[model samples]
Target: MHKIAMAMLGVALLGACQDNNVMPGPQDGRALFMANCAVCHGADATGNGEMARAMAKPPKNLTLIKVRHGDTFPRAKIMSIIDGYARSKTMTGPGMPEFGVLLEGDLVPFDSGDGIQTPTPRKLVALLEYLESIQAER
Candidate 1:
């Protein structure tokens, strides 16, 4: 099927880039980005990838987050956008799909001083870190 072919292609591409600047880590944020985001965000996170060309609304310029938010990176907002917790205004269509289940890993607990706590997914954290790393300098 198409999904199977795409998965195979992704593995091949990841293998091809193993020797490049993609750093190795327990989480390997760059690998995650390349696997899940590069098709739409481009390998450099410039938002001009081929998928963006096909979209009615071009993908966001991922590199400019810092510039857009007054030189302060909005971690919560970025994560929300990625997991579909929040919808970004720039996305005029359903071009960006929710990767919530794909981004889920071990649950992490966080308390907001209320009677309850929320568990955050680890892969989401890794993806957020990857996005933060690629932000353009202000």
Candidate 2:
């Protein structure tokens, strides 16, 4: 009886200790975008969110491949921008929030093993994937 109880306890502990990494699937990506990026980037990733009117310069139309800098979408560049590492010259004030901190708050149990080990990096990857999915084909 003691051994059985101990074994059960060990299994329970192991289950609790399991990693909680949660990678966003297609649906999760869309949902995440709607909740976080849509407010500024628009529901269609078009950069014409409702808040754009208040700004001096409207947000970029994300679907436009022509407007994208560099030959590729440059995941690092996008990540830097989202992390607030890059600033928009045309826009006044901080163009976007430093989502490095915010991503941690949004993490679900399955998406991040350590909850949010490197939120900015993880969010950058996820956002890049989403952008790639929506990018206009060459």
Candidate 3:
């Protein structure tokens, strides 16, 4: 519930900032991923980024999300992980940084595979869409 509130607040705040520079389309997702995630997740969407060796737990092989999730990509879970609200405090080692910047653009409706029409950050939604697009076969 707390996460939902926070996400809604972000959506409301971002709704007013339409002029902010944002990459909220699949065409721009590759650049967005490179700028923010490539250093950790790799340009190939594999776990073998340059920083992979340094982390206590290696980054995930992003290309295999669907394969790992029973051939169904978990959208809400992945979104929370990327936005930094789903990880627990007891989680040890380094993880992906909270991309607050993703919440500074526009708002879009995302179902997260659920029926609820949660308002989501446009950029974050774009990132999610991009991740889904790169899923490899099991």
TM-scores for candidates 1 onward, in order:
0.68, 0.61, 0.78
Better of 1 and 3 by TM-score: 3
Query: Order the candidates by TM-score, highest first — what do you get?
Result: 3, 1, 2
Given candidate 1, what's the lDDT at residue 60?
81
Report the lDDT tens digits of candidate 2 across residue range 27-126.
Answer: 5457667777788779998888877777666777777643466546665556556656686666684366555433563443222223444444444456
Query: Roughly what TM-score does model 1 have, to 2 decimal places?
Result: 0.68
Residue 96 lDDT in model 2? 62
What order do candidates take by lDDT, descending?
3, 1, 2
Q: Give candidate 1's error at residue 44 in angstroms.
A: 0.3
- Candidate RMSDs in order: 9.9, 7.9, 10.5
lDDT of 3 by residue, 10-66 (tens): 999997776544436666577789889999889998988888888988999999999
* Tens digit of per-residue lDDT, candidate 1, span 9-122: 999999777543222233456777787888988988899776888888888889899899999888667867877778755766557877656555565443323535556565
Q: Name the candidate that leads on lDDT.
A: 3
Against the true structure, candidate 1 has what lDDT? 0.72
Model 1 ranges with Cα > 4 A deviation: 1-27, 88-94, 109-118
Off by over 4 Å in 2: 1-26, 65-67, 88-90, 100-102, 105-120
What local lDDT does model 3 show for residue 22? 47
